[model samples]
Target chain A: MKNFVWLLAVSVSLSGCQHPSLAYITNQGDSTVSVIDAAQQTVTHTITVGKAPVGVAVSKELQRIYISNVEGQSISVIDSQTLAVTETLSIQGSPVGVALSPNSQTLYVADWYSDRILAIDTSNTKIQREVIVDKAPAGLVVSPDNKTLYVAARDSNQIVAIDTQSLTIQKRIDVGVHPFGVSLSADGKHLYSVNVYDNSISMIDLKDVEAKTHSIKVGEHPYCAMPNSDNTKLYVSNTQDDTVSVIDLNTRKLISTIKVGMTPEGLDYDARNHQVLVANWGTNDVSVIDARTDKVISTIKTGNQSRAFGQFVMQ
Target chain B: MKKLLTIIALAALSFNAAAHGPSPQKVEKTIVIKAAPAKVWAVVKDFGNMHAWHPAIASTKLEKKGDETFRTLTLKDGGTIYEKLRTADDADMKLRYEIVDGVAPVADYNAFMQVTAGPGAGESTVTWVGRFYRTYKLNPPIPAGQDDETAVKFVTGVYDSGLANMKKVIENSK
Candidate 1:
């Protein structure tokens, strides 16, 4: 009786809502988003999206995922419970990056070709606001506090910060050549910007009146950088070298580099599972690495030219 | 009645030939850069340094017939592009040339690049244009099953990326 009870408990935990979440990878070339089961270390589902999906974001409170299709100029919203596209939001120009509010009610999309930021109300699937920013904006992230939004300007080589409430540009900081991905620390104290051409990640102190900028070297053509849940480690995707360089934030040094697939792009660290999910653009696979050991535990084939991946909790 | 029917058949064959000419033999992509007219004139006039700005040509060898024209073999696509520099314009900053012989994908292609002063007095507008036709056919050795349109599309993608890269360099500098 005890043995049966123990098995029941384990199976219940595995299917629990608090169970380690799945990561959705957007494959640009294949027009599909792959869902990776963190516990199994394998792909459980591949959902079809619009053509050339580039960026992905997930909502913890709403239990939903958003994918931005660059060529289709739309966002496909997937419900976590059903794992189906619940809605599609059409926006102007080529939507490249997407971010969801902490409350999961709002989504911010960056239009790369149009140089604009679109605010979408998730519940209604309607455009709330259209904010214009620097030229060729790509990467996007909403603050933990849901106060400020950060965007990477690809052609302008700068990072634009906007106040979410006012929907106004608060500041613009100069970065390296072709800044692609931008992320803010969990506490919203530091802003990290990845410059693709310069192959470096710039760390900016946002708390101080005079922002102090520091840079750490990474692999060739560094494309994206994201912080761990604890904000202690940063996983950076090196597109040309096809590796993920793990950086120790406290020591400000590269501790290790894990080989992934051909030309890796987007990356996110799953806090619950302690696994780093990497999107390999060239080989069309998603690699999950054990965050504790910095080693690849498994690789799940996604699709050709997989670009971005994200994870969130189900409310 | 027989004579009239024969005349109609001849007319139909002529119309068919006019509508569908022989499939284009090959397709190719070429680039041209604009330098200061007088200064760029002499440099581009020589076939020796063709690799400097042109994307595909790795190198070049010149067999000069005179000061105005030269027979050149461009090291592009495994040393297959051969063209004759027919005219070099000093005032207009233009290069007009013809594909004399080559293994480029598109056949019967003529291209040119003309650099003219922009709206602003100091700046210049470089216009690059090419006209070519493509045909889909099988290789003789392969028993005529291969389609050539796929090859044309592949070359087009390469040229598109190359042009984007070239424009980035040129516009960023100016």
Candidate 2:
């Protein structure tokens, strides 16, 4: 009787530890979002989204995921628990990049064609405001304090910072040519932009906004960058080279280039699993790399043209 | 003169319709040959002898600068393409290359070619796949011959003809 009770206790503990975290990947070719269970490393569900879904963001507080569909000109709000798209919000321009506020109350989307950033109220699913920026705004990230938002204007080759409360442009910092993705450090002390045409990364020191930009050369046509939780390392995905360039934040130099799937575009760091999930557009799969070792440990196949451009993993 | 003008207008309209965005397009072509995987890989991995297998390639010149290797291929139609070798893995029987400068109606072209074992014994399959975007990497008012359709058609024609001719040559050699 005691052995049976102990066995029951073990089973309950195992079940409690198995709570799954999901990585939402947006497949552009087939218009679907693949929900991957990070613990099990398998695709748990495939939810149909709008046409050409490119960007994805998750709200942990609300238990929801927002996907921006470029061709459909809408955003698909997915319920994280149900694994279904609960609402589809139609916006005006071509929506590509997406981000959520710190409190998960407001969602920011970058419209590429219209050159504007649309702020949507998450509660009502309506456009709260629009801030017009430079041409071809692509990637966006919200500050940790929820005060500043950085926008990567691809055509203008500059990073624009906006005041979240005032809904106005705060600063326009010049970067490399054709910057596509922008990321902030954990402490919000640094900003990095992946320059597509220049094949480099512009590292902007937030404290010294007026100083000259520091450019770190990388592989060809880098698309996006994601810093680790500790801000010690930065991983940038080079699309044309099919490799991930790992940069050491202390030295600000490329430490290694790990080969991954073809046309690797979007990248996100899974803090719970200590792995970086890379969306390979050409190969239609997600390459998960072991962050500790900086090696590709496994490749999970997804729908065609997997491009999860924004914050996708929900811990 | 009226009929010619009408044809030109239709062509322009078709080009405009296909220039949707700067989305990456893919082209894949596969062919089976009556040869072993090793034999097929020998031909595919030879970075300098593409003219021997591909009928469209008139000549190939290989050059080495620093630690990088490059090949300049002269097409039969008088067009030239410059490519750089990225990776060649003998164990995987796979090679990857990228077009540095080319006459094709595509930009940022990268390709992978692999040789694998076929269903039957002494048979092999060669697959060539490429991902690229149209030369006009921006939205609309796209110039002629640089639209998405033109890039797709040009790449597809290149892969199809090359793979078909490769099958013929390998089978004939055996």
Candidate 3:
């Protein structure tokens, strides 16, 4: 009977260890990145990164996290297990947004001031190509198909789509004033843009560039948009209004709005826990929401002002 | 002929002493007056008459405390910007003033305007130089973070526009 109890105990322990969700949130106000224990819903550790780290991208396959420093002009690489900066990759003028390829082998950096997109090889940490884009490219995304990259040009009021293979601009579609953040659907058929000045999200049909799609009204200043794991819901961080607007993809309408800290800017979803992590720039905190209910489950304290989050694989 | 030359030399010396004088800073905006320098100087020296020249400033009031010092209030955007003129030299064709605290929406700024004689080879040159710094508060803290260059751009644009307008006013003058 004792032997049977031991086996049952061992099985329970192993099942508990099966799910370990971790995330690294970059806070620009405090110049640090908070290492979060997603399962525990708390900040396990904080790592010091470059000055004003604003953008972060995780390569799950490589078990690395890349944080973009707006003032430092470099990317800090953090090891998932250690939660320490393992390497610093130098980039061009004021790197605002960063993304990893679907294959997790390449990194794309959008330089806001220099008006260029830098493609860096993750293994060598060397720039493979630097493609010039429209004026003030602030937000970037790689299509789910991994064949094209979309960049939002703030000053030009347009989105520049580039062919990933040729590193050439494929098309320039007119967005709204101060187009800052962009995202693509899982099927790679639709593109969503957060127009800062217009305070709305522009849904574009990639197949039909001239299609008159819907413009959903959002907060006072919609800065960035993130799609759910299932690609069914869209979460937008409204900077000026200090709220996050949850949109239902099927209805193409705002389902709910949740109030956050001073200025909520960056957003991403945790597939394992079904929670959304929001980086609030003004208050320097991250709000974790239960995706099942669309309600904030807990508030995790990060750097002085945590701005963005990325995943890091456990080696 | 020598006596006539001596009289002319004396007259020129007196004219030179009358034209040139000393001052701290010069304030000169070249607005085509269709009027003479003395007439324009009459309009420029009295800070109260600035509303007629500067388009951005709706009105101004000059209250003199002493022979050389005066308090000037410029009204714009439903508010008043106060400045103190430390020195006003009509002979030197100069007006010197310093912005008072809480004078404008711009929190940190110090400006000076000078009006000297224009280029005539030997003529004086009216030079205007302003130096000030502006600070910005990120309403929603930057997610990818605060770029100091971004703040610098915001302030630089304001100063640049003001300088451009001042230049336009002076250049369009007759």
Best by lDDT: 2
| Candidate 3 residue runs with Cα over 4 Å from true position | A1-19, A309-315, B1-174
Return the top candidate by TM-score: 2
Q: Total backbone clashes of model 1?
A: 5
Off by over 4 Å in 2: A1-19, A210-212, B1-22, B34-108, B114-125, B134-154
Using Cα atoms, each model's DockQ against the true complex is: 0.03, 0.14, 0.02
Name the Cα RMSD for model 3. 18.5
10 residues in a row with least lDDT, candidate 3 chain A: A306-315
How well does chain B match by TM-score in each candidate? 0.54, 0.86, 0.48
Q: Which lDDT value does model 2 have at B72?
A: 96
State the displacement of the C-alpha of residue A54, model 2, in Å, after optimal TM-score superposition. Answer: 0.8
Interface RMSD of each: 17.7, 5.3, 19.7
Q: What's the distance in Å from true for residue A271, model 2?
A: 1.2
Q: On residues A1-315, what C-alpha lDDT tens digit does candidate 3 reach at each position?
A: 999999999997786568477777887656788878887978888889987787878875677889898767789998876777899987656777788888987799887667889998888876578899977777788887789989898778889999999899989998877788888777888888899878899888898878766789898668788778788899899875669999998899999999887567778777788888888765668888888898888988777766683323221
Off by over 4 Å in 1: A1-18, A209-211, A309-315, B1-152, B155-174
CAPRI category for model 1: incorrect
lDDT of each: 0.69, 0.86, 0.67
Better of 1 and 3 by DockQ: 1
lDDT of 2 by residue, A105-211 (tens): 88999988778999888999755799999988889999999999999998888999999998899999999998899999988889999998889999989989778
